[model samples]
Target: MAEQGSGGNVIAALCCVFFPGLGQLVQGRILAALVFAIVAFGGYALWFFIVPAIIGFIAHVWSILDAAKFRRLS
Candidate 1:
């Protein structure tokens, strides 16, 4: 919303800690939120497989970092 490392980004990153994509939603990125949610959850749903589980974990972490690093175009 403001800039990278801003308070809003910090809060968004915290939100993502609870659930992947929640931070994107907080940042008003509907498409990104949906994409992250689907990818992370889809991988998680197939957690019995090692690769998918790892993918889910990576996606979750990526979502947090993405939110934390996001900078508005304006």
Candidate 2:
């Protein structure tokens, strides 16, 4: 079996990598994703060295994981 949300998940993950929250929006995880995105972006605005990259990496990993998990859902 391929996966249910594999496509959306991949796209969302990529979006989040490029921007953020966009992945969550694609995954339909609006609230948490949006919040995470905002915080990550805001923090990055002030300190664009370590934290932002870490946050963005986390968000990307999260997207891939979420997509995999989506397979078990429906």
Candidate 3:
């Protein structure tokens, strides 16, 4: 996969801010997007506890950083 530029990545990361997996989807990482969406949303849905909330937060942060730093193939 081609890596996106820093600017693009920033935009992608911003997208992730709205939805955890959206960044990955914008970056062309469908699987990662799905995983993030499922894990975060599912965790929150399955258990309305602190643990799940924390996990979702972590996933959200990860998505942002990952998108910002993600490198794609030229």
Candidate No. with top TM-score = 1
State the C-alpha lDDT per candidate: 0.95, 0.61, 0.83
lDDT of 2: 0.61
lDDT by residue for model 2 over 2-32, one digit each (tens)? 3655665567656766666666666677885
Model 3 TM: 0.83
Residue runs of model 1 more than 4 Å from their true location after superposition: none
**Looking at candidate 3, what is the lDDT of residue 24?**
90
The root-mean-square deviation over C-alpha atoms between each candidate and the true structure, in angstroms, is: 0.6, 3.8, 2.3
Number of the top-ranking candidate, with lDDT as the measure: 1
List model 3 lDDT by residue over 1-74, tens digit each. Answer: 34556778988999998998898998889999999888878766756678887888788788888888899755
Per-candidate TM-score against the hidden true structure: 0.96, 0.58, 0.83
Ranking by TM-score: 1, 3, 2
